[model samples]
Target: MDIPSNHSNHDALWLPFTANRQFRSTPRMLVSAHGMYYKDDRGHDVLDGCAGLWCVNAGHTRPRIVEAVQKTVATLDFAPAFQMGHPLAFEAADRVARLAPGNLNHVFFCNSGSEAGDSALKIALAYQRLRGEGTRTRLIGRERGYHGVGFGGISVGGISGNRKLYGTMLGGVDHLPHTLDLERNAFSRGQPEHGAELADALERIVTLHDASTIAAVIVEPMAGSTGVLPAPKGYLKRLRDICTKHGILLIFDEVITGFGRLGASFAAEKYGIVPDIMTVAKGITNGTVPMGANIVSDTVFDAFMQGPPEAIDLPHGYTYTAHPIACAAAIATLDTYAEEHLFERAAALTPYFEDAAHSLRGLPNVVDIRNEGLVAGIELAPRDAKTTRAYEIFDRAFHEGVLLRYTGDIVAVSPPLIVEKAEIDRIFETIGRLIRQVA
Candidate 1:
């Protein structure tokens, strides 16, 4: 294959969440992608094992999504989301509401997961005030949780690294203990058996701050960016009950687990519990055009509806709130999911995926293997007193024709729902082979 000449300088662009100096020296540039593979600048096909950071659930370059975006962009590129209206925007919101669980039938669109996180936080606060609970201003997040980079998200988020760089985020935020008990749950498939009682940490926070001061509690049903930490068994339900008993809204940051990453429509569906507010992005448009939405339950919506019929309900939104291009892409993406039955496909393949993930348990540097649905995390022992082993393994695997994502010391693999059994084997086999060679 002939290599495409890359003449552009990489100095101008500052990549997010990346080591700029280290990455500029040797960049891993993907020129294009299709189906389950990404073609690097060097013209090598790298199997996508992380679903392009857990967003591209419907594979890559789907013709339907592409055509819809192209057609919509030509017809109407930009549409104001403030007071004006567009047909596609309403259509997309209705489609998303249809897929959302329980009474989560109201949708507010934004541009990305970060915006969704911040938007959800604001909505929670606004709803509390609307309901005459103006004292409920505090937000609760769990340690090791990854919301996003926005001020509100970082405040409620518990990942220290994400929070430390920006001193003192939104005030009155407390955290519940994360439920990753490695001693009892390591190498476990699906939800772990231990740490369900960890949900009580929220109760402790409520007691300390008083329930009236707490507005909402946000968590990822399965924490994704924090290294694939699945919620402990009964933990989600217990949290749901607590939030209910205290009259605090529960928000699930489903940016990573939404749109069938969990072999169901959403983590809410998989766990059989409903959250008052849910934030979703990424797979909403199959990682095509950027889009995110905060889905609110009917109760929350009804609270806002009591004001004036023509008055502004919530004074928040993005200029590109429901961009026509994103709306088009999302509609097509939803169509693709329904027609392909990708959620059902992922459900059927979970057992095979689980077995393949756990098969790496005895690998040289692997300390733990956890799998749930199509998502898996292989925790590696650190090297040279640092978390370098998984990073090296990630680089090596990319060269070996597979792409993986490493967070801290965990290698997370969550392939597209359309992935085949052969592709699954190839991904783990490549990782397993390269892991054995790690020093």
Candidate 2:
């Protein structure tokens, strides 16, 4: 493989989600990836503690997914999905629908998590309007939720930092108070025992806005980017009950939790809460190819089927919707997950992950620890004049042969499902040392 010629030319590339100038001076470069490690430009084998942004659920560079894309591009490089069809797309959608929750029988394809979220929101609103509930227009999100960076996503997303400088977002969006009770739930294992009442905040928002005005309430079943706050015990059930009674739609943004990340195929199944709609990306193609699905229940889907047989049902779709290559990639990814039983692997490894995560309990600056399945988060106390002790730990861990992710003061870890017990120990041990070093 040929490296890009402009090794020193950071000026030419405008990197996304990065501090461009700082990154140019101190760049982290990945030259290759294998199972559970990335070989950096300097040949350092850094263990993957975050599963390549929590998408490579089956580890990296699997032959099946690689071959599928190779075979697909050879046969058909592109297929116009507008008023046209392809077998791979149809087959992949069928496969995804079969695995998707409930009568989430319909699949609308897009390219990324942001697109999946925006598309799901649009589907909820459009379906409501089609059924003559046109007034149900407002979208309800929770504080601290990270629903991608698209216009519709940002509008509903409650991350003030992500939305503050973007100018006024889409109107009629409200947020339920976030469910982060660090005082009560700190260092608790798995789903914290407290804060189950947080779901009831939706009722307050609903009463204030009147349930009829809201099209859907979107949330991560376990908030990931806002620092891995798993939904409190029975909270998801309460949210479901409220949505059921109010005739409101509940949308789970399962982009991060989809596939085998949660030990179950989806967080919906793990929590046993059936949302009316769900948006998924990331693990769809093992993060090998970009793809997303806006999954709608049969009722919501049939709402669009009401008007006519030969007419266009939904007036929205991407030009690359159901791209053949993406479909091929998704199919092979599913095969890889099933053949290796990665979801069950995650379940089996949860206890080891939990122990390793909790081992950081006494480390300096380690304020709290959260763990679920193969994922863990260590919250760091702020350094003076800075709220980012975890960021320092992140950079330090990369240099110490481990890669970690940081959101604010929290360092998150979600190793590939294929991570072994020894690897798990290395992950937390390295993190523990890094935390002590920073403190």
Candidate 3:
């Protein structure tokens, strides 16, 4: 095989959330993808085990999405989303709102997960102030939470590595203790039997900061990016109750778990919980385009609606808020999901997936395994102090024809909803081999 080369120097790009030097040295490049595999620049078919960063729920290059973009580009590619409006944009939002849980009937569009997070935080702050809670400026996040890299996101986000470089982020942010207790919860299957009491940490924060000044609490119904940590049994319910009692908004950052990763349409629905707002991206367009959404309830939307029309209800949005092409892709993605019944497919396949996922329990160095719906997290012991065994397995799997995602020592596999039983077998089989070979 010939060594691949970038047309220009790769260092100038300055990648995000990446080890630029390490990645540029041993670059893994993909040229095309279809169904459950990606054709790398080396012309090797790499099986997808992470659903392309937990998006691409429909898999890659679905014909509906391809055709949607093809025809849309010719008809109308770029249109100003500011003062001007488009029918496709409204149609997509209307459909999305209907699918989202509760009276989450209002949708605000942006370009990515970070934008969605920042926008939702702003909405929470602005909503409280608009409704006479102007003093409520504090935001709450859970430790180990991953809410993208925007300024407001970094403030409420709990990842130390993602925040340490940015200096003191937006102040007045408090964190709920993350519910990943490896000692009591190790090797647990599905939701852990213990740790429901961790939700009371919210009350402790409330005692110290006072709920009157807290604007919102944002958490991933199932935390991703910082490894996969599901909310403990009954934990999410208690959080919702506390937020209700204190008049603080609850925002579910569903950027990864939304769009059927959890079997249902969103984690909010899968777990029987609803939030004041939901931030979604990734699977919304099946990773075909860059788009995200801040889903708000009718109450929140109505609060903003009361102000003067010319004054602007909520002074937030991007120039690409509702780009015509993105709207077209999203509409087609939804239609494809309906035609294929992908969500129902994922739900039905969960038992099979869970069985296959948990079968890795006794592998060497394996410490824990957790699975719910189509998502699985296989954790291994660290090789050295601050060394990530997960990354080792990830590299081996990718080099051996499977693409899996790793954060520290945890390997997260949430394949596209359209994945077949054979592909699921392949994913785990590759992972099992990689685990036994490393160290």
Candidate 4:
């Protein structure tokens, strides 16, 4: 492997989800990463607090995953996904399906969570039509839910900032009210005791839209990108019951919560609420290679299979649907998780992680703290009308030897599942100190 020389010009590349101009001015570049730490360009060892954007569950650069990618690329670099078959693709799909709950036994591979979102939506809409309910075209999502950036995802997604600039996205898309209730559930541990009735909003939406017109309701079991809002206790069960009653398919965008992030194989298993379709990525390949998948129940897959034997059941797919390298990485990643028992490790660490996170309750400008499993969110009060305090803390924390993620006024902490007790303590203590310094 050859390391490329450091390029002096940063203007050639535009970073995603970043203030590019601000980033170019004083760049914080990571040169390498391993285990729970990243080495930045300045030769500083930074603690990975957010697990590289909530991915990298088994930690970074594990030998098995790295070797798999290298060996697969050299042996079978690219395989056409449209018609050509590959043994690795089938094996990988089987592995992922076995981890999923219930009859979610079929897998559709794609390149990222964004593609998985669009793919899942298409599956729901097509499944409804195949079952002779073609009128079911409307899709539902919740406020502040982040479901990647595809047009289909954005239409169902409820973040105003992500939607406003994109113009009127897909029609017949509606959103349920968000579950974040600062006054009622602030600083609560695990799932908040209040706001369970928020799921009733789905019932209201069903009434307003007429259940016949709705195809699916997509949501994150534990909303991650919109600052880590865990589903209220009983909230998911109510949604599940309502969707089942109305004949609407339920989809869980578990890109952030899948693959042991919630101390279970997936949030569906953790909450015991199996969705009709589930989108997963990030941890699928341990963030080593880009891969996402839509795992559907047997009922949904069977509906599409009723057509002619030679016919293509679903017309949607990506060019890199089951890229050979990605399949190799995913298989190795799953192997790492099982061999190391990382999921059980994460479950054991949840209580300690939660306690460490809540220790910032008394810090200045700290408004609320919420957590579930291995993830947490520390929300800060706005300095003015703008929400830059969290970003400031994030920047300071990076310079002070910790890497964190900031969205709006909230900073998220989701370290690798392999993180130790001391590293967890260091992560929160750094944030606690930085919160005061920024204030």
Candidate 5:
């Protein structure tokens, strides 16, 4: 494979969630990737530590996914999603629904996690109206929660930087207090013991706004993008109870936690709590293709089914919703997961991954370490108020032949589920050595 020339024009694209100026000054480029590693421009083996931004659960460039995508693009590249259908689209929906928990038997397809978030929110609002509760238009989100970048997602999302420039988002949107407490739950493994009471903030929000006005409450079960803050023990179940008591739909934005990232098919299955509506993406097609979905329970799907025989039930979808190639990739991806027993493999590797992550404790500037399943976050005490330490570490790690992710002075390690124990050690070892050198 030929690497793009370093001297090539690099200003034509504006990268998302990246420092474009700094990247242009010194670009870290990858030419190719296979199982567990990426070949950089210089042809160095860079071990994947974040699984290509928390997707690619299976790993890079798997044979089945590649072949499926190739065959699909050749035969049928595009298909109209509105009032039309394809066999692969229906087949993909069936595969995803079978893996979902409970009676989450219906799937609405989209192109990315952002679209999935917006679609799930719209479905909740529409379901409420269809059930004769048109006044239930308010949406609730939690502090430090990350859904995606869509207008509805940003409105319900609580990341300050993601919301500050957008100005006042959708009206009647409220946020529950975040459950990240390093002081109380530092160095904890799996689910933290404290902060379960934080879920009661939902009840308070319900009292303040009244249950009749709320449509749904959306949250990330592990809060991956906000630096891997796993939910407190009993935290999710408490929220589920409150939402059930108040008749508000509970939406789990499982974009990052879906498809074996949490050692199970989804965070819902791992935690034994089923939300009314679930938005999923990322690993649905193993990051080989762009695809997402909103999986809803029978009750929610049935409500929309009643008022439509000849009429369109839902008046929303993207032009590429369930595109033929994406559907083919999804079906092949699900087949790969089942045939390889990757979910069970992830479950078995959790202990080794967790121990490797926690071994980095007591290192310089390391403040807190929290991990669950295969995902871990090592938060550093900031060198300055700007929180540049982790970014520095991330930059150094990439050039040092390992790739990692950083956000707000926190370094997160979530390798592909196919990673071996030795690869897991290498990821943490590189991260540890770099953290010491940064300060």
Candidate 6:
């Protein structure tokens, strides 16, 4: 593999979700990746702790996925998703629908998780209108939720920083309080014992605006980007019950938790509760190719089919909606998960992963440690300056030959599902050592 020639220059490109000036001054570049390790620009092996932004569940550069993408691009690179049809698209959508829980048997393709959010919101609104409930235009989200960065997503998303700079967002968006109760549920393993009552906040919101005006409620079953906050026991079921009673749609943004992150095929399966709609990305193609999708229930699809036999049902879709190569990559990714039994692998590793995570409980600056399945978040006491402690730990961990993700004051870990027991030990062990060193 050839490295980019301009290794020293960082002026032309502006990075996303990064401190541009700080990063340009001290860049940490990944040149290649394999299995659970990434080779940096200096050729140092850095143990992957975040699965390439929580996507590459099957590990890096699997031969089967590579072959699929290669064969696809060489044969049919692009296909017009509008009116024109492609075999791989149908095949990929079918595979995803089959993996989805409950009656979510229909799939709509998009470019990324952000697009998936926007597409799901549109589907909810459209589904309501098609059912003669055009008044149901309101959407509900939860505080601290990270639903990607689209206009529609940002509007309903409750992260203030992500929404502050961008003037007024969409109207009729309300947020339920976040479920993270550090004072009451800190350092608890798996789902915290408290906070199930927090789900009732939706009922309050529903009463404020009336359920007839609310179209859907979107949330991450296991909130990832805003720090790993798994839903409390019974919290999701309560939300599902509320949405069902009100005839409101429920959308689960499973971009990070989808494809075996939560010890099951999806978080819906892990909790035994099904959502009205599901948005997925990241692991759908095992991070080898860019793809996202919105899977809806049969009721939503059938409602759109009622207008006319030849009429265009939903007035939405992307140009690259099911690109042949993406479909091929997705098909191969599903095959990889099944053949390797990675979902079961994740479930089996939870106990060991939990113990390793909790072992850091007494480390300096460690305030909270949350773990579920293969994901864990170690929250540090914030420095006088916000985010300073977390960034320091992140930078130090990278230099010490391990890659970790830092969001706000929390250091998150979610290695590939293909990770071995030894690799898991190394990941948490390195983080524990780094935390002590920072002390």
Estimate every model's Cα lDDT from 0 to 1: 0.92, 0.89, 0.90, 0.94, 0.93, 0.93
- Pull out the clashing pairs in model 4: none
Question: How does candidate 5 score on lDDT?
Answer: 0.93
lDDT of 4 at 303: 96
For candidate 2, which ten residues in a row score worst on lDDT? 381-390
Candidate 1 RMSD computed on C-alpha atoms after optimal superposition onto the true structure: 3.2
TM-score of each model, paired residue for residue: 0.97, 0.97, 0.96, 0.97, 0.97, 0.97
Q: After aligning candidate 4 to the native by TM-score, how far in Å is the CA of 97 from where it should be? A: 0.6
lDDT of 6: 0.93
Task: Encode model 1's per-residue lDDT on 309-372: one tens digit a residue.
Answer: 9999999998899999999999999999999999999999999999998888888978898878
The alpha-carbon deviation from the true structure for residue 263 of candidate 4, after best TM-score superposition, in angstroms, is 0.6
Model 3 global lDDT (CA atoms, 0 to 1): 0.90
**TM accuracy, model 5:** 0.97
Cα misplacement distance, residue 143 of candidate 4 (Å): 0.4
User: In model 5, which runs have C-alpha deviations exceeding 4 angstroms?
Assistant: 1-8, 385-387
Candidate 5, residues 179-233, lDDT tens digits: the string is: 8998899999999999989999999998898999999999999999999989999
Error at 412, model 3, angstroms: 1.2
Q: What lDDT does candidate 2 reach at residue 176? A: 84
Any runs in candidate 6 off by more than 4 Å, and if so which? Answer: 1-8
Winning candidate number (lDDT): 4
Displacement of residue 6 (Cα, Å) in model 3 is 13
Question: How many residue pairs clash in each candidate at the backbone level?
Answer: 0, 0, 0, 0, 0, 0
lDDT of model 2 at position 88: 94
Residue lDDT tens for model 6, 14-90? 89989988888899999999989999999899999899999999999999999999999999999999999899999
Error of 2 at 48 (Å): 0.9
